[model samples]
Structures are given as structure tokens and as C-alpha cells.
Target: MWQNEPPVAGDLPAEQGIPTLITWNHGGNVVAVEGSWDSWTSRKMLQRSGKDHSILLVLPSGIYHYKFIVDGVQRYIPSRSSFCS
Candidate 1:
């Protein structure tokens, strides 16, 4: 949820999956290597939390990707030009 924040406590259900789940970072900032973040506290907590349940806050590598067409040719334009001003 946040980079420099503590776990949020609430009455959430761990049913089907981890009690409390957090998707990508608040701003989709990939923090670490592939599975390298596996050692982080969030992963650890997911491990210790219980069985049939898990939690992980992975830091994915940053990337700028998008599908577009340029010069009459199809292209995978990852740049911000697609959303230009």
C-alpha cells in the first residue's frame, strides 16, 4: 500500500486468500529483483500468518509499455507520447 507505512489493521477476511491483501505499490513502483523481495517482511508475514493463505508485496521492475501505431506501422509504444498533451 505504502512504502514507509505500517500494516493496516482491520476486520478483513482471510478467506480464499490472505486476510489483508495489498496489490502493487501505491504508485506501481517496482522496488526489487525477481523474487528477491521474497525475503521482505511482507512475504515473511504471509508465511507466518497461517496455512491455505499467503501474502506478498512484490517490487516489480519498472517499465514503460504500451501498444500503438506509428508511421502506418503497428508498434509497441511504451513511451508517454500515446498520452500526449
Candidate 2:
């Protein structure tokens, strides 16, 4: 089984101009971020970092909703955001 630190709950405050790193530990072949940051039109592939998966996104300061797509199935990270059907 793959083990990784999940995304922090609530709003994520920006630091400098660096992108925010979001992670998931589903142990899937592919993982991607789908959200308002990209207008929900594309999937930003998350790289496999050790036993976890992560993506770097530089988004504007705002409440942008998002979810993860693991191997073509959508999944939600609890306490982070509601599941988008």
C-alpha cells in the first residue's frame, strides 16, 4: 500500500509566488487535479513523489473548488471539499 500525507484542510495561504502542492495517496496509475483554477477544463497530472502523488498549482487567491481524478474516477479528499458528482 502507498502512504502519503494528504492535503491540508480549509484554505491554503500562498507563500511568495510558489505553487501550492496538493497530494493524494490512492496508489493509482494516474492522478490529476481538476478544479476552477483551470476552469475545470483540463487535468493537471500529479507526479509520483515516492509513495505519494502530488501536483503544483499556482492559483489566484480565492475559494476555488476542486477534486482528484484517479485513474479516470473522480474522488474527493475529506474535509477539503465536498464531492463533485
Candidate 3:
């Protein structure tokens, strides 16, 4: 599940700005959200949930590109439009 909006009442604090929660349910040992936010160099490690991995990011209002890195492998979600080069 990929949420670009902040949750009403949940684990994320309301004062932490807009929260974008990215989650992945897989058997990998590690997962991350890598994109232009970090120059596509570093990986923001996601926290482990019950049977999934997730990460909460506070981002400004705008559009951004990103992909998931699971166990050192990069995977991109297919977009309807040509957003990726």
C-alpha cells in the first residue's frame, strides 16, 4: 500500500508534517524507499510491521518519483503515463 496523504489518527504524529507511508509485503530481509528526495543514492529503510515493511516520510506538497529496493534489487511500478525517463 502506498499512501501519499497523512493518516487521521495512527502511529504517525500529526505534527510531523505530511506523512507518505510506503509499504511492501514480501519475504525480503530489507526494504527501502529510494528516490530524488535523497538524490537516488541512499535508501530510507522501512520499519517492519506484522507481515510487511513500511516507512513514513514527511514531504512537501508536490510530485516526486520513487522506487522500491528489496534485498538490493530495484523494482519500479508501471505508470500509466511516461513519467520515467
Candidate 4:
């Protein structure tokens, strides 16, 4: 599950942020996530979970944009009217 919202009754204090589970279901030899959290600088690695790849991120409450790097290819979920970059 790719959750963009901050969890309620979080594991950590509100100031410290909460652990959010991010999962990538697309198949790839390598999978990672980059987002506004680090201005896309840090490519956090995701471990394989059955057929999906996932990672736990501790993020503060806010809106964030993210993309997946699958086997070195940057991918985004396209909207119905837009094409994938």
C-alpha cells in the first residue's frame, strides 16, 4: 500500500513523525522511491516482499510527490489524460 497521508495515533510523537509503509507493486530487478521529502536527492531502497517491493518511511504530516525507480528507470503513475514520463 502506498500511503501518502500521515497516520493517526502514530508510533512516534507528532513532532518526530510516523512510519509510513510505502510499497511498489511493479516488477523490477531493483526498486526505490524518491520524493519531495529529500527534494528527490535520496533514493531509498525497497526490499522485495513476495511480488512487491516495499519500504518504511518516517515522514511528517504533509503532501508529498513521489516517483518509483524500477531497475534504474524512473516511473510515475499516469493520470487518465496524461502520459507516463
Backbone-clash count (model 3):
0
Please, what are the lDDT tens digits per residue for candidate 1 over residues 1-85? 6587655655454434223232222121122112222332221222222222234432343331222222233333233322211
lDDT against the true structure, per candidate, is 0.28, 0.77, 0.71, 0.77
Return the TM-score for candidate 3, rounded to 2 decimals. Answer: 0.63
List, residue by residue over 1-85, the lDDT tens digit for candidate 4: 8889776775656577667777778688789888887687899999997899899888877767788889989887664212122
Worst 10 residues of 2 by lDDT: 9-18
The C-alpha stretches of model 1 lying farther than 4 A from their native spots are: 1-35, 38-43, 47-50, 62-85
lDDT of 1 at 67: 28
- Give candidate 4's TM-score: 0.71
In candidate 3, list every pair of residues with a backbone clash. Answer: none
Q: Which scores higher on lDDT, 1 or 3? A: 3
| Candidate 4 ranges with C-alpha deviation above 4 Å | 1-14, 79-85
**Model 2 agreement with the true structure over 1-85: per-residue lDDT tens digits:** 8868676854466544436778888678788888886689988899997779987777655667889999899999878773222
Report the Cα lDDT for candidate 3: 0.71
Candidate 2 structure, TM-score to reference: 0.68
Taking every candidate in turn, the Cα RMSD to the unseen true structure, in Å, is: 17.7, 14.0, 11.7, 11.0
User: TM-score of each candidate?
Assistant: 0.18, 0.68, 0.63, 0.71
